[model samples]
Structures are given as structure tokens and as C-alpha cells.
Target: MVCVEEYAVRVLVTGGAGYIGSHVVRSLQGSGHTVAVLDDFSTGSRRRVGADVPVEDGSLLDTAFVEASLRRLSADAVVHIAAKKAVEESVADPLFYYRENVAGMQSVLEAMVSAGTRRLLFSSSAAVYGASATSPVTETSPTDPSSPYGWTKLMCEQMIRDVSLAHGLSWSALRYFNVAGAADPTLADRGESNLIPKVFRAISSGVRPQIYGDTYPTPDGSCLRDYIHVNDVADAHATVLEHMENADLCTVYNIGTGTGTSVFDVMTAVRLVTGVDFECDICPPRPGDPADVVADPAKIRAELGWASQYDLGSAVESAWKAWSDAPS
Candidate 1:
């Protein structure tokens, strides 16, 4: 196995200017690894990236551009974090999700092949496990994606596996649960569809937030999710990269807190953090919705020696602080 400790490692992050991607970039740099960025700036702001980092501004669908950037940087590893992640939006437009998430990943893989970069750390989701009956879904759980977004992530993982088998690529797909909070106020999640942002947006507009469903099988009769902190998610990328470089194997690990928090529970947390007793409307459940989706993080904790540091309240507190500070 090739070790990155023997020499300096340069990692190219595909969506380095985006929310999670930006934090991952900072984490990699802090770990003494040289980092560069490749993003089109469509959804990500250039301000999120450090001015010193060389950024290749282009779409991942453009294989030539990605390959050129990879070759230019001679990156030792590629952290593919670029993708459209809204589940509802994906169900509404499956074709767009396929093109952006699936096809875009293919372009990244093709570019890696051309550039002779063999290491990859994929940004995956628990959505790939769909509506499993398991309380805390394990890495070995049967994958049955419930949405187009989930399907795209599963397909990307499969592609990485195939590429590894055929081309000697070492990879790790960190299947993340609900990612929340911000390392910095400027890095706060600006996503309209994400739950925390949605709640903040509704409160800011003096409107009650909508709770999609209240008839699920869970204790709270709402969707249960493992909301992991973004900083911890960022640290997972760095740790997993180091693991892949030293071990040189293809593997999958769930990146989340083993605990689960329901949608209603999240609203309560928001109220406590923001000191606003906001009401919510229990509306019909959206399509492609799952009841419970938490992570069985034993694999990562035992293998990589990494664990989540923030609890649900801390996630809400940090997220509210950043959300409150963002410009209207």
C-alpha cells in the first residue's frame, strides 16, 4: 500500500466552494495536506474558499476540464463532493438528478482515470438505505433507495467499486446522515430545502413551518434522522482520506451519530436555540419520504477511531447562530 505520510499529498475537492465541501477543504489543509478546488460556482460561492487555494472553475460534466485540472495539480486523491442533494427536488425532476449526480460522477471518474489518480473519497448519503426497518442502519444493511436522489448516490458508489476493481482505484464512500450546523457563520448552509434553513426561513417570514407528516411509525410519528455536525462530517473526510491512502482498499462507512432525532424534535430544538415559540403545520407527507434513517456508526468508530463530537442541541445552536447572522 502507498502511504501519503512518505510525501506531501495534494487533494482536489470537486465542490470545494460549497457548504460541506468548504469545510472539508479547511480540514484537509489543517491536516497538512495540500488542497485545491474545482467548482463551477453555480451553487457555491467563491468567497467560501481560501484566496490562496488554486481553484479550477468549471463544471464536473466537462470531463476535459476536470481531467486538465487533475493533471495540473497532480492530485494524490480526489474528494468528489459535487452534486444536487435536494430529495424533494430530485423526485420532482428525476432526469435532472440523473444527469447532475450520476452523469457528473461518471465525468469525475473518467477524469481521474485519465489523470492517473487512484484514490477517491465519495460524498454519499443515508438515503441510499431508503426506508429500512433497522433503527440504526449499518454499512451492510440492504440498500433500497426510496428516491431518485438516493438512487443516484447508490449508483455512484457502485461506479466507484467497479472502477476500483478494474483500474486499481482505492476508494471510500462515507454515507452521511442529516448534515447540519456550520464551522463559520459565512459557511452556513444557504440551502432552501434543508430542514434547519427552512425552519429559519419560515420564522424569518413570520410564518409557521410545515411538518410534512405526523403519521409515521416512529415514536414521534415523524421522520427520524441522525443529524451530524458539519465539522464532524468535514473531519470524517480528512480521516477517511488518510485511511484510504495508507490502506489502499475500497470500503464504505456510515458517517453519523448513532442517535436519531425526529422532525418535530428538531422544531423544538430550534425554538429553544432561537427563543422563538414557533408553531408548525402538520401537512401531508411528501413523496419519496422515509420514516426513520439513522446511522450505525460502529464501523467507522471502531475502524477509523472517529466519533461525532456535537449533539442535536449543539447542532441547532450552532446552526441558529449562523442562520441568524446571514444577510436576509
Candidate 2:
């Protein structure tokens, strides 16, 4: 609650049926904002998208659908969350990643301009700061994305800045760290790019959880990352959305807890929370994995008055509960 009034607006969230998008939509709706979803439904489904939320079943690449939807909803702002986000998948097929993530962003921006939607919150990623030179990455830290997926995010950030330079657009790019868990179990992350879901998938299959590359230079010889709950990520989205509306923002911020959790730390927490003791099988390191990446939220905290409320254990516990309850 940054304002005396809730600062409600008609928001259009792209990819609203997906995992992170769904939670963001929920957060926006809870804050008394009207919301509509535009999704292709390739990886997202109607069930995760609530019946109450209005939806336009279409692709972001299709400028016609995007323009029509923006005009139809008379959206006050747009939160661009639709992108292909898998590191390994991006490595395997870089062209597809570029075509979908980068090209789709272009289409969205064009549509927003066409529909007179000037405010936008772009879903950037910590992957933009690939590997880590500093322990706690600040907004001004050097960006050297090691993977194609990370590169796409960086490109989108540049696009936002360039677009704003040319057009009257107020935009913010929040570079997310690892987003996990859910506000509700039903809305828990279903994607397999993260540690929690991969651990769940492995353990449930009667195999030990696999930790890639235990030889990284870090405490306990494993990579460290900032794991923020999806709900907290969504809350940051709400905060940024309101912040964008109030002021001129052609800037970037890291969306993360100002702390780091190692892979081994997460495994222990998962075992403790699930009460299912399992060993971890250490494999070779992935190509682009950095030793560690933690966020310095000082800038965002002082400016936007935002911080992660949930701890890492709570996030893993919620995901485990959802994984256990759902049919795999």
C-alpha cells in the first residue's frame, strides 16, 4: 500500500495463465486492480487462469491479437511476462528463443503504442547478469549473460529503453532471481527450469535428487542463488506497477531477497520439509552456471519500499505441498 488509495488500474498481463503470470494476476486482482490475460496457452492452461479473470486466447507474436486485446480492455498498463525461459532449452535452440522471446516483445511494444498504453512493467531476469563478479549484484552491476535465455532478457531491456527514448513510455525492467513456490498450492510453479520442481520430479520418481556441478567456487562448493517466493515476485510486480504509474521510470531493478542460498542448502531444506530423506547425486556443471548470484535490494528497498517476505524454506515447503497434493 504505497498510496492512500490502492491505485487500482485496468491491467493486462501477458501470459497470465502461466505459473508466474498467474500469481502476478492474482496479486494485481487482490490489490483491487482490474485485469485481463493474453496467453497462447502453449504451456499455460485455462484451469490455472481463474474463471473470474478475463482472457484473450492468443499469442503475443500476433500483433493483431495484442492490439485488439489492449483496445478491448482499455488497459491502463501492460505487464510483459510472456517469454521462453529455459536455460538448457535456449542453448539447444537459440533461434527459437530469439524468435519467441525477443520478437514477441517487439510485437507487444508495437501493440501497446498502437492502443495508447504507455505504462509497462517488463519481466527481466537475473540471468542478464550471468555468472557473478560481485556477491550481491546491484542494478549497475555489469551484465554478461552466459546463456541465450539470459541474452534475450538483456536485449528486451535495451528494447524497452530504446522504445521509451523514442516513444512516451514509462517502463521498468525488474531482473528476477530464482522465483519458486506459490501463494496457493494450486498455483505453484509447474515448470521444470528451477531446483524445487526438478527435485520433486527426481524424488517422486524413486531417484535421488540431482545437483549439477558441486565443484563451483562457493561455500560448500556449490553455486548460490537468491530464491524468492512466487508470491513475493508477484507482490514486487504490483509494487513496480504502481511505482511506474506514479513516476517516470526507464530503469532496471533486481527482484530478489538480499541473500543467497546454495544448492546444498536447498536440498537439505527440501528433505527436512518433506520429511523424505534422500541423497543428492552431483553431476557435471552446466555450461553457463556461475558460482553465485545474490541481489542487493537496497536500491529497490529504499526507492520502492519492497522486500521479500517469505524465507527459502517456506518457498520449498509450499512447493512440496503442492507437488505432493497434485497428480504427477
Candidate 3:
């Protein structure tokens, strides 16, 4: 069994003010862990994390600031979540992605080494798997990234593995599929940049949402994705942190619901939940987008005892509630 309190882990969460990172910070705090947030406020907002948590306002690119924050927080483990995550934007500017995602990670690694903090949980993506013939991808699947964003994630995974092997740093890279939905109302905030939220925004504003590429080979010809709830993703992070002692020096796990939901299915769920009649305009497929990308979460389930509780409907309902209740 993993004993988190035995070590009394103090966690330093980079990008804790962002959408997914904020949820992770909330989950960590709920689990009785000391949490310190490091965010640049570039793509993240301090309001997302609220005022209770200490927010170290700085960029991960600044090695000095990151090292200083680690020393001041005296963090035992680091959950690195800061990265430029827009796939389309990355395709437009590959160099920016490399500098922010890859180089920023290198700085964080150096800071961790300096502070004697070894345990790390990295937020990877399904993009790393690219186009897979298999419906659901396993951790052992071949990585053939089709975009600059995907390539950056794969590069970071390799860097983490190398650092763990050479420097005795224990690491877990959670390769997440589509992280949709929102945290429960008690933890809701307005700053998120995912598909669900965008769709909600369109419906609320009396506009039809645009559907990218509805001609894919799926049940409804829309893109199919494994939509995991944000809370479930946060829970997985906490589970990994709690069970880090039992994990190997370098470990990778795919985090998802193990079921695929297409864009049409998600739209149907939204309409059912909100009673809103929204139209959609079919558009060409965005570059680097695969027809289907699901996850085989068996490895994570067996290794960390982590499983997703919310299904697609539940995820859509919760996300709708959040967007409807969002401050104007």
C-alpha cells in the first residue's frame, strides 16, 4: 500500500491555475496534501485557483524562479502541468511549442534536482499516440505523433524517462485522452479551453457550434474521443501521488474511460441535458486530428487502482451546469 502521509509529501503543482491543473490542485488539497501553485498567469488565471492557495506568479522558463519556488515550498513531489496545449496553434508555431513545452520541462527538471525533489507526475496527452489503427490505445502502443503538439508531448515523455533513469527521479506520465467535463459545482471556475466549454459558449450565445470534420469513419462520422471527466483525471493524479512509493522509477499510464464518444453523441447529450436546440456547421478536419482516439486504461487500473466514475452523459451534464452557471 502507498503511504502518502508517511512521507508527508508537499506537492508543487506547476500551472495549477489552469483548467486541468486547478482541478488537480483542488483534489490534492482535498486529500490533505500541502499544495503550492506555480503559474505564469499567461494562459492560466489566479482566480481559477482562488485565494486560499499560495500562487507563485512566475514562468516555468525562468529557472531561477522555479528553483526558488521549490526551495521556498520545500515540495516533496512535483506535478508538472504547465505547457502550451493548443494543437492547431502549435502547428502554426512549432518553435514556440518546443520552447515552452520541451525547454520549460528541462528547466523544471533542473529545479527539481536542485531542490532534491524526485517524485514527479507529468500530464501527457493522447496526441502522442497520433493515428492508431486500434480503437483504444494502450501504453505499449507505438508513438507516431502527427503534429508539433504531439511531438512535443512525446519528446517530454522521453526526457522524463531519461531523467528518471539517470538521476533516480521517480516519475509517472499520465497519457490522458480528451479531458472533458468540469469539476463539481463546489469547485467550478470559468476559465477553460476545451470542446465542451466552447460548445456551451456557442449555445448560450444563441449561435450554432461548428463541427470539425463530420465525415470521419465512426458511428456518426464525427470524431470519436474518450472523454474523461476532469475530476476523474484529478483523482488519477492523486492516486499516482499516493502510490508513488510502489511505482517504478519510470512509469507511463493511459488515463481515460476506455469508451469512445463521438461529436454527435456529445451534441445529443448536451441537447438532452439543456433542452436547447443547437445547430452545427460541418467543417473540414483540423490538421493533426485523428478520426478516433480512445484509451485502454487497464494498466492504470491495475497499477494505481484508478477508474473513471462519470460516463459521457454525466460529463456533459456537469459541463453544461458549469457553463450555464459561469459568471458573466
Candidate 4:
């Protein structure tokens, strides 16, 4: 299903060629929206953005370039998805995260203001919640992020809020959970930083996928996470954009299935989907890792009539097929 709106609007997606960005871009195209892409190609691809789509290759950090692109494309809305996203990498290099995520967001918003683009969809993360006391992290959860990456996301959210207040920009910040799976096989996550891709890499390399920790206090003694498909995430973006037509703006939403899946559970799904009876070894949990991280998507569902379509089995199955078939 395409996410193109009833009224034709020119939308520019920043980092529209990356893992999640590509899915959203395709959804926009399918829905009949006039879409353009602006990506630095740092960890993105021209193909993922679609060969026929208009793509402006440049850095989001360049305010002048971002401003020029928004003006040139006559963008009516901007979906900001370009940023540094690795949790571990952010820990090792907090300065880089601040420089890219926060500063880059500033550039995008300023450009939108310059071009008179009033609508926006900002890519946020569940990392902003850190370790929540509740089972299902809500939109109003305490946002005391433990890692620098989380801090960057939280800071960016604040920046977006401030920008909207000052510029009258209509925006939605979709705080994503453990985003997995693929809408298409070729667009399956190529970066191995994510769990699904990491497991696929291990299996293809003749190594057992390692469970970070099995000693956590959960049903399976492993960390439980809310894994949402890339397709569903894309769908949420489209739905929220539609909702903005005649509703309140500058709101935040948690994007997930509102259910928990353990690392062991995901491993089993990988085995089931791939038809490989592979064993996994348990290792110490990474620092700052929480026992359970789930979502309470009530706000988004009630507001936008959004619900996830893919279950764990379908998501894992599609992901394996994508990873297996995608060029190595």
C-alpha cells in the first residue's frame, strides 16, 4: 500500500536511502506523493531511494545545501531521518553524535523554515526513554537516557519541539523501538549493527549467533524488546502525516508492537525461518542494556488509527529472505 496523500504534496526525505528511510520513501511513492531524497550516502544508497526518484546527494550538516535543496524541490514537508544511530558507537564518540544528530537536525529545521515547509516528521528513538520503570514505555515516560546516543535523541526531540514553537511547524516525532525486518528483500538492513542483520551475518559466516545475556530477569532470562517491522514503521509515518491534516501538531508517539520479544525468542525465530538448527551461546549483557524494553502505542493508535500488521514470525521470515537474497 502506498502512503501518498489525497492531495499531492512535495515531500523531501532526508537520508531517504538508508535502512528505515528507504521504506518510508517507498511508502510515500506508493501513496502518490511527490517525493524527493536528500542523502549524504554516508551509510545510504541511491538505489534504495529508487533510481527514478529525484535524489540530491549532500550532507545534512550543510545548512546552505539543505536550504537550497528544500527551495529547489519546493518541498511542502520534510521527513528528517539522517543521523548517527549506533548506541555503542555513540558511547565511544559522544562528541560526534552531538555534532551530527543535533546540529544536523538544526540544519534541517532551519532549512524547512527557510523554504516555508510547515509539516515535518522527525525520526526519534526509544533510546530516549533509557530504562523505564513500566513494562510498556509510553509517550510520557521518564526520559533519562543512559547512553550518549539516547541523550542525542532526547536532545533532538527537544530541539524539534522548540523549533515548532518558534516557527509554527507542524511535526510528529516517532520514537522507534527495535526496528527490524524489511518491506522488500533488497532493502533488508545491510548494516550489521542491528540484531537481525547481526544474527544473519553470524549464521552465514558459520558462527552461532550470540545472545547478549540470558541471565536477565525476564520470562526467558533475556532482555525483552519490542521489535517493530520496518514496513510498519513506514506505515506509521504515513498515517501520522495524514493525521496532521486537521489535528493537533507537535506531538510524540512511540512506534512499536507494544509486545515484548526476547533475544532467545528472536534467535528461535531466525532458526525457524532459516530452517537451520543452530545453537546460540550466551554472553554478558552490554553496558546500559535493560532487562525489558517494550512500547505502549495507545496514543498513536487512538490518534491515528495505527496498528502493526506484521507479527514476529512474518517479520523474521521476511527479514531472513531479504538478508539471504540481498547482495553481500
Candidate 5:
């Protein structure tokens, strides 16, 4: 077992102004750690982070800027969360995905080496498992990503492992499932990318939400997914950081609730939360989408003592509250 250390440390969070990144910043700060943010704000918003947190506005592709920021902050660890994450967009433009997600990760690794920052907590994805994964996916599950986005995440995880072997960088890659909801209205997700927010956007525009597939082999015939709260995912990042020791440690864990909720169930939850009896359109199954992609969180629970505190209903409620309050 890797040794655990107890002390407050300064941490730099890349993409800290984004949805998940913002929550992570708050979680780390709540744990009494000094926190700073590094974001280009391409998809992130400055309003998500507090004024107390120092922001280093720049691109991670620029290794010099990232290195300078780490040196200036004297960071004890780095939480790398900056990456393009739209699966469809990645499929449309594989080159952009490789450059941004893959090359950008390399740049951060290089800057970490140059700046002498040893500790890292990477924001990986469950996409690495891709379609055909069994329900309740584990860390040891075979990685056969179906899309360019998942490929980039897998490549980045490998890079982190290789860097750890040579540079003695203590690291943990958290493969989180579908993250929904916000810590509060101010920190709400501003994008219309994922399922919950996409549905909210559709409803807000007076259009019925679209269910991609409804004839899967699930209990409800709709696809099942593990939707963990953004706050819980943020908390997992803090827990991994707190438990990391000063040794050359490389670890990976699945961050999720270990439960699957069908798409119809999510729509039902949305109606209950928003009190809107809006109907949904059933569409053909999306290519590469699995019938079920829930996480098997036993590893993180037993190893790091981390588990989700929010359920599907909680996620839908908070997401609706935030989306309803977001400005036009």
C-alpha cells in the first residue's frame, strides 16, 4: 500500500474554471489546501471560480506558460482537467482531439517535469472502456475505446504511467462516469453537451427532449448509465490527492456510484424535478453506445474510502435548479 501523508499542500488545478474543475477547486480548498487555477477559458467560465483563487490564464499546449505557472505557484501537486470532452465532436474531428487531448497532455507532462512538480491527479474518463463493456465496469476492464475521445484518454493515462516510471511522479488517474449537477447555481454547468444538460436545453427551448435509443436490453429497454454528481467527482479528486504519498506511486480508480439508471428513468426524474410534463421523442440507437456503462466503484471504496453521496434524483434536481437559473 502507498503511504498516506497528512499536511496541507498547494495545488494547481488546470481547467479549474470549468464545471468539474471548479467543484474540485472548492473541494480542495475546503480540505485546507491552498489552491490556484490554470485555464484558457475556451469552454470554462471565470465566474465558476472564486475571486480568492489566483487564475493563470493560458493554454496548456504552451509548455512554457504552464511551467512558469507551476514554478510561480510553487505547487505541490497538479490536477490536470483541461481537455476537449465532447464525444461527438471528437468523432467529427479526430485530428483536433488528438492535438488537444493527446498533445496537450504531453505538454503538461513536460512542464511538470521541467517545473519539478512531482504529484499529479489526472481527470480521466470512463469512455476508455468504450462500448461492449460489461455493466459495473472496473479498473481492470479491457480498454477498447470506440471513439477518438476515449482513445485520447487512454493514451493520456499511458503517458502518465510512463512519466511516473521515469520521473518518480506520484499520480492517480480517476476514470469518472457521467458527471451531472452543480455544487450550486453559481457553479452550474454552462454547456449543453451531456445528457442532463442537453435535455434541459431542449426543454428550455420548448422542444421535446430526444431519447437516442429505447429498445436496449435493459429493464426499461432504454440505455442505462451511471450518472454521478459533479460534486462527488470533485470530492474523489480531493480524496485521491490527500491519500497520495511522496513515493513514486501510480494508481487508477473508477469514480462512480456503481448503479445504472435508464434513460427513461432520467426523463422521469427530470419531469419530477422540474414539474414539467414535457414529452420526449424516441429516436434510433446512437452508434457505439452500449446498453449499460455503469461503474463498479468497489476499488475506490475499499482503497481510498471514497463513494458517491448523491443519487440520480439528486443529480437531476440540482441540474434542473442550475439550468433553470442560467441566464439566456
Candidate 6:
């Protein structure tokens, strides 16, 4: 059992019933810290969270309810993970994305302020740097969000910074790039959208998997991305919580494997893992797809002493195992 140092403080995880959030909850519990989960079950499932933890079923947009919940729980720190995430969906409905991702973050910040919770670990995304110039983007890379979903994440980062400066809160925003694989077998059943899961589903069903735009400026003529195991991402969250007290206002870190793997490479790995060769259809590039996006994890390593345990092969293996073990 990987245990977090015994901290008597209680931690609250928003979107705790979701994939990444559920893993964070488990990590916290394993570390001997008490955890409370707040989720609306919009994209999250109640079954993902452990049966023992208290899960408040409500939306983060409900300010009063959020405030009441925080007050009642008397949480020591909050890990905000709930948000609208799909890039294409955000493009279709920017307003909905802003409402859920931006507005909901505001409500959570206000509630935390009211409840006297000054420490937070925000689950930010690398989408903020939509077509970044640097292959391995550092924390200081220019943020040129290309999609509505990315814009929402940037907006939330600004919110966290402002709140931290004004209210003397200590916060860390982890800009995650390609959070792939599953930590728990049960939670893996709820996986969606990510390239690994999509490919796994198609290969398992003996259907052709579609690969959009193969003529990109890469070795394999496919877009490149840094794939980080979900377990590593979860562990980084706990690391942030442990260092929250000493952290300055609003620190940011890039969480990734610091290596880029192309779509073709991923498919090749998938084929090797499943021992099943499937056809792949090449379609026009998706509207917001970037040519290459990786992360420079030096800041995270220096600041939190965090490192990824799984590489591309290990990541694909874990994801394959999760999908293989899941019930149909």
C-alpha cells in the first residue's frame, strides 16, 4: 500500500467520483489522510469512489451547497478536478464550457475562501498551450489556447492566481498532458475519449480504428503527445498537498513523461499488446489537434520531487490490462 505521510488533516476532492479524481481519493486515503468527495455525477459515477468516503452529490455551480458542504466538512485542503474537458464538445458549445469550467471554478474558489480553506491543488490541463512552439513545454511557455475547452482552463488558472494573491491562499495548478492509462481496474471501466481507451475499445471489438491526419511534421507522420500514467498524475496531486503549506502563492507544474510518442507509435504498441492487427483509417486532421505537444517535467521534479514511473510501453501495458480486465 503506497501511503502518504500520516497527515491528520482532511482533504476534499471535487469530481471525486470521476476517473482521475477517484484515483486521487484512493491515494489520499492510502496516505492516511481523511478524504471527502464532492461530485455532481455529471460525467462522474458514484461507484468510482470508495464506499467508505462521504460523497456529496451536487454541482459545483451550486455556490450555497458548495459553501455549506465545505463548512460542514471543515476541509483542510481542496483538490479541484471537476470541469468540462472535451475539446470538440467545447467547440460546439463554448458557453456551456465556460459555464461549467470557468463559472464552476469561481464558485469553488469563493466557497473555499468562505470556508477558510487556503490550500488547493487544481487539476489544470496542457491544452492551455495549444500549438506551443517548444516541443517539451515548460511552465513558462506562452499560453495560446486554441479551443474553448483550453480557454476555459486558462481562465481557471487566472482565477486561481487571482484568488491566491488576494486571499493569501497556497495553490498549485498541474498542467497535465495526455493523462493516459487507468490506476484502478474498476474505475478503468468508466474510461472515455482518451486515445488509449478509444484504440483499446476498437481493437477489442475487431473494428477499424480511425487515425486523423497522418501527414503531420513528425517521424511517423502523426501528431505527437506526452502520455503520463494516471497513477503518476494521482501521485503528483498528493505531492502537491504535502507541500501546500510551504508552497508560495499559485505555483504551476507540468506533469508529463517528457517524451513524445506519435499516434502511429501508439497504435503499433497497441497491436503488440493485444496481438491483434486492425485497420486504421486516415481522416483529415481534427480542427484543434496540435502537431506536437510534450512537457518539461524539470519544474515538478525540482519543486515536488515527483517523477513518472511508467513510460510509453508501461503506460500502454497498464491501459491494455485495465481494458482487458474490465467487464463488458
Candidate models: Cα lDDT each: 0.91, 0.89, 0.86, 0.86, 0.89, 0.85
Q: For model 1, what is the alpha-carbon lDDT of residue 37?
A: 97
> Which of the two candidates, 3 or 5, achieves a greater lDDT against the reference?
5
Q: Give the C-alpha lDDT of model 4.
A: 0.86
TM for candidate 1 is: 0.97
lDDT by residue (170-221, candidate 2, tens digit) is: 9999889999897676676778787899998888888998888987889798
Error of 5 at 104 (Å): 0.7
**Order of all candidates by lDDT, from best down to worst?**
1, 5, 2, 4, 3, 6
Clashing pairs in 4: 2-30, 2-31, 3-31, 4-31
Residue pairs in clash, model 3: none
Steric clashes per prediction? 0, 0, 0, 4, 0, 1
- Candidate 5's residue-wise lDDT over 1-328, tens digit each? 2222365788999999999999999998888788999999999998988999999999999999999999999998999999999887888899999999999999999999999999999999999998878878999998888889999999999999999999889999999899999878878886766899888888888999999888888998998899999989988987788787434448889999998999999999998998888999999986567778899999989977889999999999998888878655
Root-mean-square deviation per candidate: 2.0, 1.4, 1.8, 1.6, 2.4, 1.7
Per-residue C-alpha lDDT of model 4 across residues 129-169, encoded as one tens digit per residue: 88654679899888878778888888988988898899898
Candidate 1 local lDDT, 1-328, one digit each (tens): 2234653488999999999999999988888889999999989988789988999999999999999999999988999999999999999999999999999999999999989999999999999998764768999999999999999999999999998899999999999999999987878898878899899989988999999999999998999999999999999988887777568868999999999999999999999999999889999998888999899999989998989999999888888898888654
Q: For model 1, what is the alpha-carbon lDDT of residue 303?
A: 91
Mark the regions of model 2 whose C-alpha exceeds 4 Å error after superposition: 2-6
| Residue pair clashes in candidate 1 | none
RMSD (CA, Å), candidate 5 to true, equals 2.4
